[model samples]
Target: SILSIGWAQWILSDLPQDSLSLAMTHPEMDWPTAHAACPVLALAGDETLAGCVPARRRRQLRRARQAASRCGRIALLSASGSPQTFLDQLIRLHNMRWAEQGGGVLANAAVEQFHRLSLPLLDAHGLVRCWLFAIDGGTVGAYYGFHHRGRAYAYLGGFDPAYAEESPGAILIGHAIAEAIREDAREFDFLRGQEAYKYGWGAVDRWTMRRVWTRS
Candidate 1:
């Protein structure tokens, strides 16, 4: 048996007939079993950061910025070279944010190890995009994602929920979206979620699927 996950789109139609037999024992069940909706924000080549969001969201963003500013001097820093510091901060904040919900996606040591091993390689190839949001030298938020081939994929992020009123997560994401546009990414993919906030940022649903295969 074999299983493949996180395919951005269906490929059953493109598969060779011979391979299809080996790929899935029950195509219909396998196709929809692990499918999920992903939100993606399409970017026009010539849009201001403000233009990426709808009018209502733009107002919310403005208020978030103002609230965050009142906390301290706000700063958004891009990660380069070794990103251990950013990773550490992100994990801490992420865990803290989701602690009440059991834990975060990166709460496992093995998962942390995966990022440690892979981020450098991705960074070297200019695919890794990470940012840390700080207030008065203290990190409050982190955005860890990838950008490649005109698509910026927002993989994961964490922010200090203590400042939820300031919308730190939203602010970090908004900045990342603007940065993606600056880098000429045609799409900002908020991967695998139907979260209401994703739609607030003018993102639309794009589905992804996972499939498993068993020997006949």
Candidate 2:
């Protein structure tokens, strides 16, 4: 007999009663493991997008935007034709900050190549989105994410550390969240991680479980 295993599978909805009963009745054949939490921001509220987050975060974002503006005009640019250019920018900007720290998620050639090959297909499906943050006409940050099935997933981001005081990443996220609202997404998912910044945006955790099946 062979066994199948799944890890950290996102549980977006309740399981059928029959499925639960099966798992309980045949622990050896099927069972659940520890759960992982993902931070998600509800976008279905009646409040405006600006009001979706906490007051403190709003104030902080204001200050950061003002600070960054002082350097130059800030712009959030979206990829229209070929998203590859924006993806490259993301990799460069991300590496500028994470390289010294032993490289970021996009640092490896394999990872970069994977995105290069997959983005076009995803973009064709209208699921891929990339936003570049620029100050004084120079790009300082980039956000890579996806919108699907009424949810916007904040997948990855990279920023110029030189603009640390300006909070380019945070500012870009604010704009991205607004875009998500315009798209009528029901939730803005942070995907995975317990990063403190996610909570600042009033994100709540949703749990997912690992399910395993084995032949007896």
Residue 80 alpha-carbon offset, candidate 1, angstroms = 1.9
Q: How many clashes in each candidate? A: 0, 0
Model 1 residue 60 CA deviation in Å = 0.9
The residue-by-residue lDDT of candidate 1 on 1-216, one tens digit each, is: 134554433333323223443345453334423357878888864445665678788788889999999999999899877678778998999999999999998999899999888888889999988998889899888989899999999989898888889988888887888888888999999887698988988999876544444333
Over 1-216, each residue of candidate 2 has an lDDT whose tens digit, in order, gives: 113554433232333223453354544434554457788998854334565878798889889999999999999898745778988899999999897899998889999999999898888889977899999899999998999988999999999999999999998888888888888888899987889999999999876555554444
Q: lDDT of each structure?
A: 0.80, 0.81
Whole-model alpha-carbon lDDT for candidate 2: 0.81
Indicate the residue-level lDDT of 129 in model 1.
89
Model 1 segments more than 4 A misplaced: 1-34, 45-47, 209-216
lDDT of 2 at 79: 76
TM-scores for all predictions:
0.81, 0.85
Model 2 ranges off by over 4 Å: 1-27, 44-48, 214-216
- In terms of lDDT, model 1 sits at 0.80
**Model 2: lDDT of residue 31:** 57
